[model samples]
Target: MLSILEKFDIFGVPIKLKTIKKQEQFKSSQSGVIAIIIMILSLAYFFYVISLWINGKLIPKVTTSQRMIDYTTYEWENSEISFTLYDIRSKINPFTKENNIIMPVLLEISGLIISAYPRLLFSTLQVDGDKNVITIDKGKLVLSQVDGSKEDDQEDIKQYFVFFTKCRQDWMEEGGYCADQQTIDDYFSTNHGLLFLSINLQQYNYETLEFDEIKKTQFFAFEEKSPFYSQVVLQKQQTTIDDGILFSNFKTFEVIKDYEVNTQAVSAKFAQDTVITVDNIQLEFESLGAFIFRIDNIQANETILMPKLGEVLAQIGSIVNIIMLLKILSNMINTAMLESTILHQIIEIYYPQFQHVQITKNFLGQIKQVHYKGVEIKLANFQHKYNQLLEIARTKFTFNNLIQEISRVQLVLINQIGIQNIKNIFKIEEDLKFFESDRLSNSNHQIQNLVSVLPEESPKKSEFERFELFNSEFPS
Candidate 1:
């Protein structure tokens, strides 16, 4: 507590301590609350952004389904079916003993039958893992009626059994002939129990004998009128010849099971000697099992749901908001640091004192009161004292007595506070010098010794001697 007579001022400026403390506390609390609220709002926005990303990935309901069509045409006269035979275990044809000629039989049939007919047969079949297709070595001929039923064998349909090799044009006229029993046996052999058969149903032009327009084949369609095509597969079968002396391992050739043929409903029309009709067809897929189907006739309608461009941009802008929040926090911390430093410096400006006073007897005994007190006078009471403190802060200490109190305090307080903070509190200038007490004492002792060398009292001098000494010292 300060006496009413004691001056309370800093650097000639009066301060209302109670009012400053109240106002500063209010400001600090408000600042802290505002900063916390801003940080919470920023964190909420960040969580909102993260939630958007989570919803985009975890929710499958956001996807949309659409209807589509495929407007593709099949030319009956242009389409073809090909049969290729491969020896699986050997690079050489088993019968011919030729290297790199494993394909012993190559049969291709082109006309209206392959295009219009739904069912065709190959006698022997195997699957090629590398090519991902079923191969047919030799095959019986079978035809399907327009009503999706099989027709009984007829002589004319049997004559259609031909070995048509496009690579060997000179084999016969019309690219092939009917194969005899000997020819079939000589070419196809399963000695190694490994044989492969592959057949491909595709569209080509017979008149031009060249490829027709390559249109997109539909794997699926929206309308039931569209034709769905499926790739054929090989089912296991066995054939023994001469009581197992020679046996052929074969898999029956079949298209994908449970596949529906919708081409029966399509109307076939002849125009300019070419069969033309718009139909949806499915191409058999091997690995994925499910097809990304095509829609026939009508274009697909698609709907997509996504965050708007502005929303995405706003989410990105949250990063900037976070940066600004951090900046605000940093500024608040810096202001707090600066205020604390200033407060400490103001308190340190007052020299603290400890005094012993006699106190009235307590319940136990009479007590000695130890009072801790700060400087009694302020700048207004004794302006010179404040000036002295400021001078001491800015200047070097030349004498040991001048530095005793501050030196001891500095050493004691160094461990309790940061050096920078302590220096700031004391308003210590960089130019101020410090000396070790031992060194200062040694210097003082040396000075005392030099002084002691001088005589205790100066000899009495006459007026004439004093005049002569003055003339020698100063010739005037």
Candidate 2:
């Protein structure tokens, strides 16, 4: 209530003290109860009106502000590891116009935290080319380890948030996993054009930073002509060597590859070798955790890499889920409004605080071509500008909790670029509360239909009203 009162001042003029005194004087009367009820209803109505106004009036005003591509859709991994995230943007099918998805993102993931030197982190597989084979590439290391001790292991994830994940959303809105036969095989490593982030990440900085000083550094955007290109990081497996057929990074954990062990292998210069090569035990314990998996060779004593604990669990779980999903799929079963990885297909969208809104994209898309006999609401009326409105809505209205790295990096970017001049009327807390209740995995979230709800006379009617001019102001 106090917070609500604080927000009312943003409307500019306050109610006079005389009115307040008069209202207090009438507090004990029978009419006061009715007045209070009226006041509450009015307040509620105001919020509803505001929601419509923001969607209707303000959204339409910002057209070209919307269509920016969101290549880096999701992120995971802690701040200590050296992670380079990669993504691919291409048509899923050359023949079909709509099989395109930006990147099949890994919205929800959990892996082991302990560092393994020279061992490949459990990674997302990348496409080799336009073809399906995955690739392994390189990038930078952020926030250098001060003591340089790879031994500093973190048992707990240092508070990372999961966003835009079907799994998380399913768990939240529907109150459990979507128990359809949609198995893991239909999902993981396939022709599905996935975006893989070799999440050796310790710091996930999706936002631009602002700084007090002119902190100079070489940085480039993801735009073309930008030197840094998004590269694919392949899942760790075998690689043939100059000498003979050798395993890449061997792990007995999540994966098993059969190979000949150089029984003469002295595993001491461990960095040079792949697996327990010397013909010793049947299988070597490459690493430790809850379970151990091994690769059996037709030949004896071949070495294999030990995979991390979390990867192993996720892999096995994936295999099980695939088997189950295949069975369900064969039955010609549909989940019937269950959770879906394919949210791009969900039409009847759930919107904020409005309840189970049966709004889907195709339904809305069809609504435009729709002609009404009773009322004169034609989607064609606002089709052109309204499309732009939705495009601008893609520019994520981020409300990042001021993490230290975020604060530092943001200060460098936002401050350096004079982003402070932007006067935001809404409180960070208030906007964050609204975002949490609205945009995320809330059961009520609707795919924001940013169609024009404002008249032509509105200030926001302009295409790019809210955003500042381009950084073309940079030194030439």
Candidate 3:
């Protein structure tokens, strides 16, 4: 079984050759250097794989893609939005010389007044439109859309007109009088107050099963004289997250706000078009402080977390295979070096005259030929001779044959000399010589009788038979 295994020339399996002399098992410095280099490269490759795993490159990855959507037909049940107005009142005292006492600005959304001093006054408001309404429920604001709204047409969509005004009929009636000229001067002073509008949007979180709020705030400084109008476009965003652990996808809704203020100044006559009138009484306020919020478009983004364990393993295996190519090259170098050494030894042993022969090899270190004293021997011829020598050594120097030859030589000495004479010659004690001369004499007499019964002309004689015949003829 071992011999069968040795016959197999498997790569990377080292099988020691018993036929080759131990000293002739050749090694070269080039092979040793190549082996060291291969070891270093293998270590480097292992570390490289470890680094990729440690850096999260071998884990799941997130990818995102976005596309535009029509807001009219999209659902808004998973989202909530609200707006907050801040810093509308002046901090300076009205009685000071500067007299920078700006009155609190009121927020008019869908004809419902929201006071700045007390924050939001009305929790819900319904406008006289197709399906226009704003309501705050469960700490979140909801905007209702018209049923069966057209996708391409947005004329009937609910547009929230938020107006920041002062000195309205309700304000005057509450105070029981109008502001004096000094108070009016403070309202329009050089240090105009800044209004900050914060739009809070909440989206459902699938992982945590909760609502996550995102706030976008923008500040606008009220103009001292002319009024400007701003247009706010609220866009809807639908995001889908692929959870690897759960092996499922979750969707959430988000509202994004984009606004632009018209820098062109509007005259009082032109601003009167946007003024809110109650019982034919025009409200007194600046024209520049109004925002029209409308939901017009939607955006969809999908995030995918790709699990890549198999791919990472495949990548690592490919890299290892590439590194193993160097190991194959190292094995080839060692094999060539060993073969060249064996060839030189064979030539020196078989032909002593070629001891000083010049051996030639190719670029790959293969033994090509041996040249000595105008005679040349090719590699094939040298290998043939080496095989013949191996066959002869295997047949002649076997263990069993060597043992048999030693046994035969011992028998001949015992028969020729008596056991007692042999013991004295070898300095053996009397108890050590177990066999007696009578037993030996009886064995010789039986051998003589057996030889006499044999044919005179035998095709072949055994070594013992020939030895016994020679002894009988010479009367030894």
Candidate 4:
């Protein structure tokens, strides 16, 4: 009874004897954390639900029909299907007002990149990524025209995206909203394979005290009828990012499988200066970069359909001379016969007695009288010839006139050559422009180190060929 009473006894009857532990002894969490967490989880759930709904919508309905699709895959060199870049200024020092602000430069630039349609073949741009390398599996330049199908090819379509998806939950935990966009993957279906674009670390603007905004952007040309999908993602690279970038003013684009230009140039070189040579005249561009297509090795000799105008004209001139000479020789061979023989023959045939009956008038010593109409006698010039027939031959079949008509053909050929060469060069110029523009626009193609042919005439061609007015090649 005594022990029990002592345990239950009011021991601190004196106020000074009572005491409490320190406030720091108890552990607690920050304010509003639970609410924010709940909110975030709810949103995540909502997004998931929306995704499910979208999938549900895409589910095919019951149908019965014959359908065909070509399961095709293509490997394109340096086909940069997606790209993402950022300009960031983080508030590393909150007191300095240098908020870790991410300037999404690519967001603004996204709307400007026009998709360059893939070509039938491609030339690669060789580059050192410092960490990675790409080697080709095939190098043959064989191609037929693009699709003749009514529907456009899907893989050739052009699209772009710039995105940064982060754990809004994690960001909320860190008191931030943005995540760095670091990787991009292009899913071109089973036939086309997938293409991935990764940011080169060396290309990053790490100490971004300021941002160099990308202005004056435009669309790169693409084939007019193609279809493809695109995606962009922002990823972290030893850094934290905040905020998403917005894109403006982008239109859809299509691609072509077969595009025809009047002139095309392809360059190819052997691998590492091989021991044997197959051909030296053709420039090897296959080793340089991603080519939508490689123009085949054109046999210039085969394409040279025009002969030297001077040579052909000279031959024609010789033919004319020969014909003139032949006519003169024929006149000499029968000079007397053609004149007097016709008269004699005509007189004999018309009047048989003319051959025996002759009245002669001699010169000064003796009496001489010219033959009468019935006389079958020879004369220097025959007036009894077929004048109508000779006139017809001279008028309708003159060798000189025939030569004049033939000469027109040569002039026409020269004109045609001039016009055709002009057109060919112009066409080459135009295609070269497309190639250059495509090379520059392709993010994967490292064109910064190489020089490409210009859209206009080459420097030498412009200075020399343009002035060589009398060259046989140009055919004035």
Candidate 5:
């Protein structure tokens, strides 16, 4: 019997129990075609999804808005103070080899018998120029003047007092007054009587347009507040002297002040500083424990890639391809284990069995041709039994066992019902023929005696031989 699945063909492929074997070889069948289509489409979509992810294009349209958030902060600081070390000099050609100067400023603190003094040293000038020297010596910060007694040597030497400050904001807020030398002098006198230097400036005179002879030398001094002072002040000035002019105060100074720094709504930036520069002077203040730096007011710009429904379906399709592959494997296994090859083998092994059943059917057909009423009823009953047995065997064991079981049932019918019924119908037809024949009375008597001697239960040998002879002689 055919299974429900086996009853139909889809896409030119037979859906039989044993068809799985065909799939194992990748036959050109409906299931194989469908699987191939699924696999191809699924893989295509899978790759498409991957490409979208790579290009960052998988985000859905609905999720484009970002939620705004508020954050409060306190105490903004900078790692290195942003203060100008020098006013941009118009005459200083920094790129020219003749005027370009590289200065090394060292901040050093001496140890115990080392005087506990902080020193600033100018190294290259003492070694190469030999024109002047600046250092912290004997607990005093000093600057020695350059000797340019001759007019020719005067123009090469330049002098300036360097000032540095701790805070950039204070310098900007003070309206430049904090840089005034007189203000620094007054401020210094109140704090301590610091030593001050008075010297003449000659190199590259801004007004004279030429360096002239320096006619005087002077000593200057400043007191150390503390090496670890959280706030320190610096002053830089140029000294000028002439035949008609008297020595006077220098230019500018810087001072540190103590005030409460405000902290409030500070936005944070999620970015890096792209430009970096070095500081001319760096301070380490033992008075301040920590110097905190902050970069704020930056907006957060986080992005996420979200897949669309189509992309999700594509992913599911890829997964379904895997299931299809598994199903193919399952089909191959079932074909190997359960699908019947026995039917084919039975047909080959039981050829004679089917031949015997065919012979019995032929005999029943002959009995029908005779059209004897009584024998037709018996033949019909036997034929019904024959058909039933054939149905049972074929339905139960499938096509493979059909021939073998039919042969067995035919043998039983031939012995019990089929042969006797066919012989009886043949004998009745011969008797009717004998009556209708234009034969002698003796021939008729002989035929009647031959029929009587054929016993109802078991016929004699002579009588059976005579019946065969009469059957052969009977008209068609």
Candidate 6:
């Protein structure tokens, strides 16, 4: 077992267990403190690393990069835009003393007029004068027709406008509200009517096979002094996150609104290929008294969230390497000190004259020479004696010789008694009757002098006599 164990060397060189014990005891008072310090530091750093790893600090770092792309590249044809208007203006009814609010009655887009009705899908409408909401589904936009005939001229940019009006008296009467012209004028002028516009822009997500809506709310106020116009620019943004092995993609549309008030009537032509005039304040029955907006241009922003596994590994590996280096350095120092101490002890054991000798060491803490009785002895001489002692210590008594002797005795016993008789002898019980009779006889005798039974002169028997006596007992 010892021979097999000696063959296993972890550090390229096998060290004796005795040498390690000597190092532990040599200058133990000082070395113990240093060992304790090293142990504390190593354990602290080890636990610190374990805690960081447990807390996910060892995971890959996240990185993000953003860029812009053309609107044509984006899938805008499948996207939809929704508009929701809320009337927050207070209009007290003369009869019931309740508030009356007006909502959009018609939606005009590209010379086509469509009835304005609540087309909300997710939420209910609140019309208690607090949150009177009117939802309109605008559907999808035709970008190619709005951009123009020539693809190259699309860079010049054109806007598409949609108008919502609430001026019709019949539409107001249907809602059980006042249909008089004076009531309509007073609602617009005295109340300074405010409309909460919620624009929901939706983008199609190819990954989820669904549409994600991004909603923006703006407040538009109608005053007798000036007209308020809110211009909104729709921009598309896509984001991707690297989730370990796969990436998660999300698409969302962003609405950017620019509000301006024109004191005079402004003429803004917003159509596919024709122009239309816009008035500052619409008292006329044919004018759009509600909100007006146009889609200006489209811009795309792409952001990517990436994980840096290599950098994380490098940082963790660097810390582990520093700790391992410290451990290896400490082991090397201990090994060197152990070797020097072992050599000195071996030299003292071989030569009693060197017991009081002073050993000199170099800066590296290696034994350079030994000084004794005004004479200097080189470490090479001591090393030679140490090697001789090691050889003597390695010489062990072989168990093979003992095993051979046992085998010979077993063969002799087998030949004298036959294998079957040997087995029977082992199985037989001992006879205690002779032992009992002998004990009784000895008790009855009670010899006074114990020296009388001592032999005066005895003749030694030779090997032949002993063999004859053995043969007589066995008798083949």
> Considering TM-score, where higher is better, how would the candidates rank from best to worst?
3, 6, 1, 5, 4, 2
Task: State the lDDT of candidate 3 residue by residue for 1-476, as single tens digits.
Answer: 98888678566556666535464355667767877877788778778766665554444454445565443422344313333322235533321112213233323332232212222222133223211112222222223444655545453333445544343334432423334567766656655455545555555444353457776666666665655566666655555444443345554445442333333455644434654433444545554455555554544454545334455566777887787787777778878666556555654554454465576767676557666454565556555654665465445456796788788877765665545555555642333545896556456544543344236433343522322211232221
Candidate 2: worst-modelled 10 consecutive residues by lDDT:
286-295
The TM-score measured for candidate 3 stands at 0.45
Q: What number of backbone clashes does candidate 3 have, counting pairs of residues 3 or more apart or in separate chains? A: 2
Cα lDDT of candidate 5 equals: 0.32
Deviation of model 5 at 299, angstroms:
26
Name the candidate that leads on TM-score: 3
lDDT-best of 5 and 6: 6
Off by over 4 Å in 5: 1-33, 49-290, 293-476
Error of 2 at 77 (Å): 71
- Predicted candidate 6 versus true structure: per-residue lDDT over 28-113, tens digit per residue: 33355556766676677667655664454443333333444333322233223334333344534221112233334333334232
Scored against the true structure, residue 466 in model 5 reaches a CA lDDT of: 27
TM-score of each: 0.25, 0.13, 0.45, 0.15, 0.20, 0.42
Off by over 4 Å in 2: 1-319, 323-376, 399-476
- lDDT against the true structure, per candidate, is 0.32, 0.26, 0.48, 0.29, 0.32, 0.43
Comparing 1 with 4 on TM-score, the higher-scoring candidate is: 1
Give the Cα error of residue 84 in candidate 4, in Å.
27
Please name the candidate that would achieve the greatest lDDT relative to the true structure.
Answer: 3
By TM-score, how accurate is candidate 6?
Answer: 0.42
**After aligning candidate 4 to the native by TM-score, how far in Å is the CA of 218 from where it should be?**
23
Tens-digit lDDT track of model 4 for 145-241? 3444433543322222222121122213233333323211111111221222332211112234122322121122111123222222211111112
Cα RMSD for predicted model 4: 53.0
User: Candidate 1 residues 1-476, lDDT tens each?
Assistant: 57543566444645545434555332444456667776777777667665654444311112323333212111223222233333344443222211111212221222222223222222232324333122232343322222433434321221021211112222223423334445434443433232222223322222332224432222222121232222232111111111111242222222211111232222111111221112333212111011111112222222222344355557658675765666576567557544543433543543221111112324322232311232122223233433454465434333564487678777756644446555554553322436666555556544543344235342334422322211232222
Q: For model 5, how does the per-residue alpha-carbon lDDT over 27-111 read when each residue is reduced to its tens digit?
A: 4344455567767767776777667654544543221122332221222121112111121222221111122221212232211
Off by over 4 Å in 1: 1-62, 68-87, 90-183, 186-315, 319-325, 348-476
